[model samples]
Target: MEEAMDGGVRFSSLRFISDHVGFQGTIKTSPSDFIVVEIDEWGQLVNKALDEAVYETSKIEPEPCHSVKKPKLNIQNVSIEHESHGEASPAATRYADRDQDHEAGSENEGSVNGVTSECEKGSAGLLRSLLDEKTHTLLDRFASDVKGMWSSKTELTEPSLALSLGKVLDKKQRAALHSAVRQEFPFLITAGSNAEVVVKPSPEYKELCHLVSEEEALGFFKYLDARKENSKFTFKPDTNKDHRKAVHHFLNKKFGNLVETKSFPGRDHSAGNPNTAAITVRFREKARGKRSRLECERRKAVCTAFTLQKENLEMFEAISFLAVKLGVIPSDFSYAGLKDKKAITYQSMVVRKVTPGRLKNIEKEIMKKRMNVFNIRPVGDSLRLGQLKGNHFEIVIRNLKNQINDSASLRERILEAIENVKNKGFVNYYGPQRFGKGKKIQTDQIGLALLRNEMVKAIKLFLTPEDMDDPVNKAKKYFLQTEDAKGTLSLMPEFRVRERALLESLHRFGMTEEGCVQAWFSFPHSMRIFYTHAYSSRVWNEAASYRLEAYGTKVVKGDLICSDEDAGEHFPSSKVHLVTEEEESANTYTVHQVVLPVLGYNVQYPENKVGQWYHGVLSRDGLQASRFRVPALKLNVPGCYRHILKRPHNVSHRLVRPDPEVEVEGSHADDAMPSLSLSFDLDASCYATVCLREMMKGDI
Candidate 1:
């Protein structure tokens, strides 16, 4: 109804996605892709001329706070440069990061030619060796980092091998860069499927900044000088390759005794191979244990057994709230994870557990505040950081793109593609968002390192424990490496050797079965989580095999019969009246479904060559979808939440038995580590760390 300076008009229930006007019918895409595209389009529009197009933008206070400006990219003209080549190696990596090649000399320009960093014999020995080592490294890192990774390179320059794989970054590294950089960037996804969006950092920016440290701005400046100062370039590419993995590395002895990682997302799925998403939880407020000396001494007796239960609602909110309730300023209580505002989540807390029942009114107060508690457990030691494992998530997406659009429409095309992917499977290409418009995908480099280590570990120690000494397997593993490094010591030890080490650890950390150091130290914080995006992938493979098996075979809907009581067990059979059980079982098969909610998949009119767009694409062919990947994380029952179980095959578990047969020292002969926990409800893109952070928050 209203017109703008550029003369773009607006209407009810209508929006523009990248110069294209959409109003439910004109454009559409999958929920996740649509969300990303929309955000990108909106961001592009907003950044064009902030003064002319910014929404309700106010003038900034022209304060001269460090005149250094960060990198800036033109959103409209932004396009990721795709790298095209083969497997890369550590020597091939030129850019330096936390673990980057600090020893490497200045990189030569225009090195994309097929020359190897270490070509051997006829080939460039340096290039070949580098490629081999880096390739394995990149792959293993991809597998470890549960959050996934990304890589960014200046458009005009060559990207390192790590950038090509994506997901080689650490949390602190990313945070440090985010804190420093102020300019817009382009994200390139070389590997790994993930959800992300492009937007002008606004409300979230101005507000979140309040939480940033006073030196955060300055710190970023320092970091920028350390990385991009020398390069007069901008942007980079993903080897144009697809599929990258995240790597998890043990980082114990780093946080000390302050905190530890939790094993599972929550009480629901803390057993084994947890299907919880990895969520990162940064401490926003300080702990109660670190308060003033006077307060600590005065309340030492009363505060020792301070336990937080579901009944004690205020106990978990914040130190301020707890201090107010204790007839004194809320201070002194410590916590680990942050719990949800709404839900009756079980939590473990540490407090004085002392005299006169200091937390006497906990039940009454919690009830008054409309909170419920299943139970609260008190332990001898405080839960350190990183003690929690991860969170299981289950979520639903509403208003899915309808498939009714007929007449060879885009909607139909998308449906078909989705069906194929669900059933057969699509190339696990890094989604467009992985290489975001402008964020330095430095993490991908780290992923490469982790993956490399894992592969070596798998090879040296044997893919399975039994194969440790298989010289053939070890050689095979070694062959996979790009470097001449002999063998990996990480997994070099034999079964007995490693068993003895763990037993020793258990002994040092253990005083009693229950009051053991293992339990106290091996909390979620102490453990780094590993998330598996294995379901859709495995399902796709399964569908592929299924389709190949049933390609020409035909069966009707009801071909499979329930039972054939008339037929004897040895000769069980069904009548021909309906599709026979054998016939149905033979021909009728499960269709592969899409991983995300469906929206037609159709290319824009000209984008498709041969004018052969298959199904309708969301928004493009006239359908709207979520701007983010709002996957329906349907969790299986008995899982902490329903969303964690996205696909039927997705299973979460933790090391339960720890292979009891191989008994040794440190590992509690009694309490065993789980392989992985079960899956549970969680929103799409929500990190498991976030959930564990919530659960650990109640711990004093």
Candidate 2:
């Protein structure tokens, strides 16, 4: 098989779809140079502003009845009433008496309407005495509003209110006012500043006010518990002891014996520390039996689907950042698929138990991370991988003047290349990202070793370095030579997560075979499986090249063809059928319709010469089909089939001069160098880089 080396990794020499003189250009000059927007299953482009109107309209449900009116409390009217009458209300009289007691330096405490006079002792008592008749009337009206809203169960459109105190108060006075408010109205929470006192309903108060009901809470818990295998869902950790206590108290008061509450130290706590603990609420043993009638009417779990637009961040990295901000685990989020790290991309993400309001709240924080999310709306189900139809790409290739003869020639060549790609398509080879940029030992080499049950060899290959002079590599070398994991770790950078993990494991377990294996296993399961995936990709690449060489643009007998009924479906390998002699004679199938199986134990290879090539390739790597099913290693890969060719749609290109204001490296300010802008749409899992490789006819 023809082989070529790129970036120190050997790959199959892929054939080009277009036969034309190639031009040279540089891509990804900036994050904005490449833009990717995912095309969903319905062929709708996923955009940052897509369905914005729908999201806006769907945020709040309409009121049940238009006749239901909110009781209005006018503080200005109360001020007028106080001005007309000289006598104060009974509540105001009690507050004045407490203020006098505090000024008299009384040691004995008094209570007024469940509020301790001790809370009115210091600056708060002085502030109350300083309040004029109109201010006292305003406080009375605010209390009236709170009671009316709480009793009537009116929908809380503005859950919080900020009451502006006429004069500025010091920090201590503000703190005292906050404490007095809490003592005066336990259901309402308050935060005070110099100018105003902000009051809002607490979680318990909200529940009591019918924002959520006891039966609704129980129903939600039942729904969540039914879906969980272990019936365990932990709440977000809180460092505040009062927050933890409040959660336990609220659950106990509401659910009573129906649910149990437990408090455990947070995951990131220090030993024997109670301050860093969290509370978890679950169904009690008595409540875990047969479902009650109310439980039987459990509501389905709803998820929020949003369009996430990120710049220069890996898909997982962006998701993790968002998960932290949303106060949910990363596993709770789902996406159609991963996108390029360095390019600006828009993709849809779905997360359960996260409301659109919560996502909207974190928009500012997320924007600081070079990411933004919008068009958030409720969805019935979470998005699954490979659910997307494809992705639309807008790419700009710069520095074209160095390669092309003239502007006219460049335009002609680009037009011809675009037409060729639209008509014939390119070889569907896995991109270099699949194997990683391992110079000394590619990921597939480690996979081959793992398949042969060489754990230590695989570990060594993973840790070994190609550049000895690099700081991280030097640390690796030191660890290899002296087995000083701790010393090497000191020299290593914190950002090198994989390296640091292995070193830490070695330091703890010692550098024995078991320790090495433990260090290897310490990696995430996805990472461990990635090595084998790289191996499969390598084999598929070679097989694809061999298929093209043996039978160029021809569909032969025994070739696997996906049935027309399943052609539009993703992962259509299950509907694959081998072409018979009669079908081959009919000459209905083309090479574009052919499919190749990635190496796996359960997969069916093509019944042609290309299938025979798989045996030779695996054998050369000291592997066989049976080796793929390794139970002990959990490496049983039920490999899937991929199309042999990919035809991009809506292919268009234009040549434009570089912007005079924008500075492109190697491009002079005075020089009007032409840049190629390409727009195309490729099916899901097809690499745009591969398409570019075809047009460039060189290593991308």
Candidate 3:
């Protein structure tokens, strides 16, 4: 980090929390290797330091292999801005912020809407703008990385981009990434030093990408015939743009005469599985004691849950007005799945009213915005998470670590982990990491969510930054603060609802709650919001390192179950008080009631399904819950390796190199097709791959 002399751009201001933010400035890739670092925020260039970039040493780790040489698949995916339009929904105004809300925001701002325009109107809308700075950076990184390893003219059993991005890296790395990508400013890190600038995808650039489900996307392939036919490839990478890119051009040049590479774009950007993804959510009425949250759905002559087009309106923005636009929900509308920002998605949203005009206003608004009009029919059934009998995750693992000498051993280990996670089990973690490094946003979000829920008192007591709370503060020293415990806890009440909904929809499994949890969410049946603690003698300490922006859990009771003993070991214990009312010397630091998921061969049901597995589930008759509410709150889990020590003593040079693959890694849903994923999602966003990554990382 550059020492500041009054006017300067600080490194802390730019680095991302969990980024492989490679390269120093403007994401310029070298001709040989891709520069990697975490770019959560960028340091403003100070006039003085600009002329004096000194050098500092990094505490680099020793690994079996360092250099990587990716295969020359010569596969190139060029992304441009994706566009959508939605003008119909009058309620679809700008997002509500503090200023906007004070200026008289509408009741529908936070409510659930059926659909936004097929193309536009949401911060997380379909196909993030490639023009956006962070998203673009992410995409560019992939493009650059692919350039280094892939040569389009190669022959292989089967391959794809998503495979590379979703495979390769460890589960922890992927979890460091989340679902929606960062458009700009990744919370990146490198060799224990902050990079000079933010390395997130360029949010400023409009982003265009495939939003289709993997199954469907993989269906569209660069057929061997196409490889045979694509010899006359016209597309090529800009040599001056990225470093890894040469790999593509070079390999293609070498084997272009022998292999063929074709690009076939499918609907939703490319091919995606048509196997419908149906979710039944049970949400509570917004108002306190307003009965179960509204459960609104499409009445397509038959009773089905309400489905929404991703772009219809902003989900986060519309949280305040679900009732007026979609009709009153009985608080029974809880869902297991969360829709994505790409393409048109089909999933049931909840609502209470089931008449014809139930969603007339919403429907009318949808039409105006050009949003896809799907049904919001009611269901004879209630939807829930883990209700779909688990996802059939199928993805392509590409551009594996260049050092793998025995493909068989690597593949075996990869598959073994899946099975290991299943038997050894894993946690059912949330994939959103937007809360920033050390889960600062998650802390604030959880604190605020609790405050909004009238749990202000609890928020105050648990989230209070005792001595050292800010993840960025240099003086403060409560390392446990880095765990994002508050954020994890905050998401749970809603998780309860989500899981319940999963049970309602699938009826394939039943998850039992572990009874009442602790007031601070430090007990079982609760989610552990790890703070990336910096303290020692704690469970989450650095010795037990956790990836930034990742969620960890254990299963105490649920449809998804394994041995009870494994629960504690898999997830941290609850923070407890020696006595119920005693405010003693010892700190409360145990995290309990975690529900872990199993993966791979150890899976009990869906014998043929692949990926990380969920051990137990919400059984058919298990306390038939109507709604699930995830509420983030403050709690403590110490020693999480979230404390980032800025390189106060070092200067910059001989930058670190990026790992070859941060991509698709999973077993076949049924071995019906070769899986596919992208590498850019590497060290980036895990939610993008959702079920695919979860399969590999899920806590059973």
Candidate 2: count of backbone clashes, pairs at least 3 residues apart or interchain = 0
- Per-prediction tally of clashes: 212, 0, 256
Task: Give the residue spans of candidate 3 off by over 4 A.
Answer: 1-304, 311-322, 327-332, 340-344, 367-373, 380-386, 392-429, 432-439, 443-700
- Prediction 3 global C-alpha lDDT: 0.25
Which candidate number would show the highest lDDT if scored against the true structure?
2
What TM-score would each prediction reach against the true structure?
0.20, 0.59, 0.25
Residue 313 lDDT, candidate 3, scale 0-100? 42
**570: Cα error in model 2, Å:** 5.2
Model 1 accuracy (lDDT, Cα): 0.25
Residue 290: error of model 3 in Å? 17
